[model samples]
Target: MRSIYLRITQPVIKLMLALTWSLASLQAAQAGETPIPVEKFFKSAQFKDAQLSPNAELIAFLAADNDNRSMLVIMNSKGDATPTVITRYSNLDVIFFHWVNNERLVYGISEKDLGAGEKNSGSGLFAIDKDGKNSRQLIDRFVKAGAPKFRLLPARTRFISTTGNESSDDIYVGQNSTERMNAGINLFRLNTRTGQTEIVAVPPHSIDFLFDPSGQVRIATASKNGITSVHYKENKNTEWVQLYQFDDTVEDGYSPVFIGTSGQFYVTARNGKDTAALYQYDTKSKSLIPNPLLALNGFDFDGDILFDNQQNKLAGIRYETDAHASVWFDEKDKKIQSQIDALLPNMVNLVDKGRSQDANVRLVKSFSDTHPGNYSLFNVDTSKLTQLGVVNPDIDPAKMAYRDSVRYKARDGLEIPAYITLPKGRPAKNLPLIVMVHGGPFLRGGHWNWTPAVQFLASRGYAVIEPDFRGSTGYGKKLHQAGWKQWGLAMQDDLADAREWAIKQGYADPKRVCIAGASYGGYAVLMGLIKEPDLYRCGISWVGVSDINLLYDVSWSDTAGNAWTKYGMPKLIGDQQKDAEQLQRTSPLQQASRLKNPLILAYGGADVRVPLIHGTKFYDAVKAHNSKVEWIVYPEEAHGWGLLKNNVDFWTRVEKFLDENTAVK
Candidate 1:
């Protein structure tokens, strides 16, 4: 490739950056009718996350400042138009925060690291008053370049609970144990006012902790091999009792532990059913109730049990299948939910309880399969839903593509669930398809909402297919279990199934179809080409696992080579000794010689999960045999592209690649 002036020349590159940023700003579709620019989708949301204060008198939201840095803004219920920029960071992204009370809030900052291992995100906790006054750094996570080494707590070291009133200055914080991997987690009551922390409770070394709304440590999960020990306690004074030990070898492990609002232990386990369903455990007797609290018809109930903190009542159980739905337990709240649903029948209305004493003003976020999200302040007193502001104001709901949940049976007669997205105002028939697989094969695959990736592909006049496949969680234990130890085998088959289904439905042009994904999905992309060589016309794999053995080899990487992966990989993925032959066959690097399709392979330099080694090793191997593979790398990126410029650059390459290969048939 010739050195392009826009990329190689420093002066021209600076000029291009100025030109690109300028073009990004001047876009507004009359009716979402014009093809939305790639930058529009990649641009940071005007408001990332917003929350109403305890009193509902004020709203706290995260928005980019003048320098494109994340900041917290405080405003009245009318919206943060003339808002007070309470907190600002030059580099860090204000990812998450919750109001400590009506007057105070604690927030955590994060840099763009989807899989940044050991690159301290400056996630240290901070607290501030409503006026942006008296801001204090409670926990300092930042480190100077040549400063003395100080170990950082877990990225999830977070505020566990707050009283939701101004009276309580102390917020419960969950800190990770610095000593051992087995030391489950420690709890501390940090005074937001005085910047002092009090050790509240410390549980035995385990993987994670389970706490109730009242700031009580109820359950702890410990792991050895694949067997996870669930330990529970009645109260703070009692000794921890063993609830049950589960072996993950069977399926992604049929288990879900959470403290329900009903004052009973809510768990999801396969008691007598094939799929893990909701079950209530008796804390007093230390036994399961043998019956489900709430079980859906087909899908596994995989949502939170709504708890009204102020009123101290169980609101309802919300779950997702084709789309998100809820079953309200509280009659009054149920009626309210029904009325809201009637009002916004096209969109799903997620209701969050208010922090006020009366709990009358509920915060509702309404969104549809096509639309992004709308923040609405629901006034319970007047039963009125007022539109506060949108998440992405540039995205017009009417101009977005149509998304539908579709189900198809795999070769083994197992029902496969997937989501299909079609371009707006375009004929769905004979469309080019991009089989976009989700990264976590164990987690839920596709959500029924406005996903930028899917919508972006759809905007380019291509149909997008995302299959949950077997082994994906939030569906059922059977499907999840079916994916156990099958990595590229059954999982790859599911991808093929999704493609064939789309072709059969007359929605996908078989000749113009391609494969693309990140992480494990990227691994699947490479394997799909290996297994079904003629199926896909092209492959785009970024930050993908090239070898199954790398999962165990890369131990220094935090999430990749950790306590949980060691014990779980043998059962969930594959045993190195037992399934060596299968793993060898599945490894993308080993089968690089088989590559013949036009492929775009990219990786993050600091990607610990799917490290740069995976990309380099595979790239070299492929280059030795067939040098047709186009390769790229984001030096500062961790896992996927998090920065705005990198994302736009990636999609620009993708759009150009698809246009070259999977052009409109």
Candidate 2:
């Protein structure tokens, strides 16, 4: 709290030291083990995303205001001046803001929700100086009747960037239509000072444009009907020529990574191989430069080049393996990376050179499985990483539990990778286990990160098991494709197998096991209770799908789900027409009667992905079956709660539910 207060500019503003959570003093139930408060795990972060300014002189970050609302706070990178609060929206949180130049910053607003889901609250763009003066609201994304922000965002206008000169009055913008999905975007150069627009170019289709360091639209890509296309131009004045097009049905397709100088196009795609590899497209030959530039073999390289602004060259590639990792291309940057990693050996050191060609000074953020995160300034010439501060000041490394990467073979002899976090200060024994399933079943669900949810459960004497089941990505291509169309059946089995594996290892009490997840993981929880009736004692699902049919049919929902309905649903999920019976049979809402254990259902009132309709209908259906149901509704929230109050409220209730049902009372 003192560190957070020191960073706050105003001293006599009556700082409230009354934190809802604390870590200072604790009773050691076991030697060297302090009981972590549940609120500490579930509460809003003390500070949010941080970034160094263009000159590396100013460090801007989002910090919890005295009111706990998201506020923009700026401090000197060298710690020469006190941190100043720039923009304070008492009603709305500044969800995202960026330093376009040394003088100007553009920020967007949204509800203070968890997971940082991009749900704009019509509270739009704001521009301010480094000193918090001349603050101007650039655009109101969806206008509310309030203090006039800037001009209307022209329906779906998004700020691209201020091209060459950050001090220039003009900024690049993309205008697209919300009326249609996959609608082509019109690129524009708008006067940031006056809100006047100049048309740069109109993309061929709803293809997204890629701007280079000089703010030139170099590459464009779009995918529709399971076929994707890429087009590139030497200059904005040149004719747009088709670079290459690939069948999106072939997995990763020809996805553009980043564009280099002279149209050196880099993309991730599999020509014939399973995993997508990084390749450079040679314009003269009009083909992918024979071999991959950087291929991770088993895993599709899902990262981008670390662009060196000073050198105007590709620095290195930063991609994810288990956690976020980086590989450098530039020797200078690589040398610096090596130095930083050696210094912060425990954490993944992500370094950013602040608009300096010399690379004498840089900002480094060190993070690990155990370490929440700490920021530092790498004085390359001095060869010292000056300690900045931890991302979460509330967390103490001494009290946090260790995360172990574990794997077990499924019934089918397929290797299932997982991370098991045992409770702090306890030996591996028959502990009450929470089988924490992840949200995105198709995504790289369970990575080794400092997750509050996982650590929170582990702090409560629960063995938290996060399994990257058959369909989860990031491991390898084969693991992900195996989950195609598995849904409630094979996917559920993989989770069950993980539980069985844990129980067999004497780490989990089979009688005290509970399944928990969000989104598709939440769907899996229902299926787990349904298919394996004798296994889990309780289950928790929030913002989860209750019906696949609803996912396909909800036109007003998020575009990702709707696109999956068109492209992936037929092949990956199931054919809506032919596989109608299978979809229904697998639907948790359809099979609500199978739920015989304690169940907690949570949903965001405004969740467009899996709307309240799914939760309410499932709740009603389960009520008829006369099963124990705890329904939690967060009205203002979208997919997940963003506000600190809502997060605390929801998690506190969940803690109670688990304690009553799964705790060894």
Candidate 3:
């Protein structure tokens, strides 16, 4: 559409851009040459979710080579005892861990079925000794089991029960189906000495269960109409005291937590205009006390109550100023604030004192994201920090560019959150932009640390933008739920709006822009190529979901099949049959011909999530349409490429593709 003068000048512009790219490309090439493997940089002593033993002499933690296959390790606190791996199942994974005694440990182990013609299997209750010696299968059969910490009660042994459809051994029968997500729970008692398991509570449909100080069961059962009624009972008595009742909507918020050693409870309740925090029954006064811990006033907080064996006062994880701060109460109601303070240090001062502001620490936890996250532990008392290593050490902080958290108003007048990383040592002008969309369409992006992909893009003289589109978690429930079925509609538009916002703010060069993402983000990349063809000159999609309809129809036999119904279907994605028209319109597979940008599609050959078929079909469809497409598949990898060679290979291909298509300089 350009005039003859502009057309004649285009060749000179292309030449100049190439010359600038080659000169800048040399400096960028040196940045990617890491001394160690990128995977090694991610590993090296980053232990997740620490659990000190009841005696506080030994500790158990989960460590992984590269956040792939995690191992359960136990080490003594004061002794010169080397940490031992109690878990050794290559095929099966340990879900949760519990200390039954000073010498024994109990955990839930299950075989994860990757849905590539695989069958979904159930997990079982497994017990191992403290020394990793006596490894025994307590359940004896495959069943859906959960981890519950055991407390040494008076006359008998007991544990906090997890309500799932567990049988005699507290394990479910088999794998869950593709359509059936609902399951019930049963309380069971296991004798440590004899390995004998007994079913204690036989409620009809117990949805959630908690154990009091005396080991008596407080169960919340859901009726057929989705109404939850809380019942408290002693021993195996049929008579139950109905303490509270609530609609299905608020049942999740009413999740029980044991607070005091004398069986006093703490729960959050909605009172009038605000959800006032309420304490459990004060038997002497026969009234509920209004909790004064104003810090955890409105937000829902949950964690293990760290008690000092005597069980006199309350101590647990609490939040303050949007950061985790621990609160513990002494006998005189003097709350001791030291544990969280010891864990999360004032890194702002450390960053100001010679360290880069781009630095971050994340606590890695098992069940909860807030529990044990990626972070360097610093002793506030001693002012000494244990460097847990970097999340992306492959990218040098000195040479690499970084982004600070930024927010812009969206088209809907909502404050859209995003991270902007400008290349280091660049003049504040119209720079080439590469918008990197995160994988989880439902997971929100934040100021937390990330991997090498973002830094790598920025190192090549391009500004990177990551928009935490709607439906992402962390902001709040309302923001998270707003993304329900807005896949290609508002969700994708948010990304485009982000790029437009960047350009309008004079942060990006409109002539040189590209979109890149992985998995769900990959789908976004292809869709960006289709929906906004002129906005982007190139795109890179790795293991992206090409067809949402195909994903809905995916079926597996064993554990994978159960996950399809239980976790996948009802949680994030809607049914394709019901949302068929929307799926077709949103899916990238149907709009392959509309892909006018230079595209690079990367896929793992053994991918079970969005199977290799998704990539294969898209590649064939695009090739048939005569679209410019580059395809790369790692034969050994599944879902994600793990090998360091594969990582370098993918990035090298990406850089070259952008250089040839887009104005990278």
Pick the lDDT winner: 1
Q: In candidate 3, what are the lDDT values of residues 1-665, reduced to their tens digit? A: 01010111111101112123344635655556433333332232335555545444566666554434556778764334667887856765565676665567667654332432232443455667777876765553322355432422121122344222111122211111124334445455665434655555445556556555334455444433345666555344556656666653333334345534354655544333232233354434434454433223323233344333343444332332122333334432121123333243322111100011111221222111111133343333344445432323333444545445566777887666677777665553698888888887776554434346666666566788888887765444555556777777788888888899899989898989899998888988999999998888889999898987767565631223443444455445666667678788888889988887789999987677778888999998898765579989887677766655677778878878877876644
Answer with 1 or 3, whichever has the higher lDDT. Answer: 1
* Per-structure clash totals for the candidates: 6, 7, 18
Question: Model 2, 1-665: lDDT tens per residue?
Answer: 00000111221111122121134323363445545666676666666678877677788888777776888888877665778988877767787778878777878887655433455445456677777787766666663565553454543577776664545656777766443544566777876556666887655554576777666778878656666788777886787777777665454557788886556678876767766777877766778775777766345678877766665666677775555667776677778888888787656777887666564677887776666887787887778777766668888765666666677888888788888887766666999998988877677776656888888787777898999998887666677888888898788888999999999999999989999999888898888888887889899889999988888777667754434567766777788899899999999888898788888899988788787888998999898775588889887788776666777787778778888998555
Model 1 lDDT per residue over 462-528, tens place: 8999999888876666788889888888889989989999999999999999999999999999998
Misplaced by over 4 Å in model 1 are: 1-34, 77-82, 89-93, 110-121, 144-160, 163-166, 178-183, 251-262, 309-311, 559-561
- TM-score, predicted candidate 2 vs. hidden true structure: 0.88
How large is the C-alpha RMSD of every model relative to the true structure? 10.1, 7.9, 12.2
The whole-model lDDT of each prediction reads: 0.75, 0.74, 0.56
Q: Please give the lDDT score for candidate 2.
A: 0.74
Which residues of candidate 3, in runs, are more than 4 Å off?
1-49, 62-74, 79-98, 106-126, 139-181, 184-193, 200-313, 319-403, 421-432, 443-447, 450-463, 504-507, 556-581, 604-609, 634-638, 641-665
TM-score: which is higher, 2 or 3?
2
